[model samples]
Target: MQINLKYFASVREALGGGETVSLPAGVATVGAVRAWLIARGEPWASALSEGRALRMACNQRMCEAEAPVSAGDEVAFFPPVTGG
Candidate 1:
């Protein structure tokens, strides 16, 4: 399936703004999408690694790793935001 991706904050700095991705079979959740990106190596590996403390959204709504994803859905990743 194909989906639009978004990167924000420091994640944007590392992975750039965003891009479209065609996921392989079994990549059905937000976490799976993350794993797929991390599998690509290079900046992706470091940028989306499991160790990173990042936030995710599916279709512009806040979501956890179990969030369902679908074709044409928008998935976003970013460092958590805070205000003082």
Candidate 2:
């Protein structure tokens, strides 16, 4: 299924904005999508690593790793924003 991805802030800097990706079956959750991208190795693995502290959203609403995702849904990733 194809999902639209959006990267923000530092994540955007590393990944260059966002793109659409056709993921293999069994990737039904946001975490799975991140895993799939990490499987690509290098930049992906490092940028979205399992240990990394980050934020995610689905269709513009904040969500956790367990958030369900479907074809055509938009998923976003980025480092947590901090303000003084």
Candidate 3:
């Protein structure tokens, strides 16, 4: 399955705009995508680190790591927004 990943705001600045990843089966969740990216090391690891404050969306809808994903799905990652 192929998934499209999008990065926004700080996330985009760290990882660039986006990329497409081809999954080799057994990896089928939003979290899996994140884990895969994190495994890429360096900027990926630091940008999407587990301790980072980030928000995710699947197919343009806000979703959690456990959310199910499939081929052609678009997953987006962005840092939480806060303004006063």
Root-mean-square deviation of Cα positions for candidate 3 versus the true structure, in angstroms:
0.8
Error of 3 at 20 (Å): 0.9
Q: Among all windows of ten consecutive residues in candidate 3, which has the lowest summed lDDT?
A: 23-32
Candidate 2: stretches off by over 4 Å: none
Per-prediction TM-score to the true structure, in the order listed: 0.96, 0.96, 0.95
lDDT of the candidates, in the order given: 0.95, 0.94, 0.93
Q: Which residue pairs come into collision in candidate 2?
A: none
Q: lDDT: which candidate is best?
A: 1
Which pairs clash in model 3? none
lDDT of 2 by residue, 1-84 (tens): 999999998888899899999999899999999999999998888889999998999999999999999999999999998999
Clashes of 3: 0
Backbone clashes in candidate 2 total 0
lDDT of 1 by residue, 1-84 (tens): 999999999899999999998999999999999998999998999998899999999989999999989999999999989999
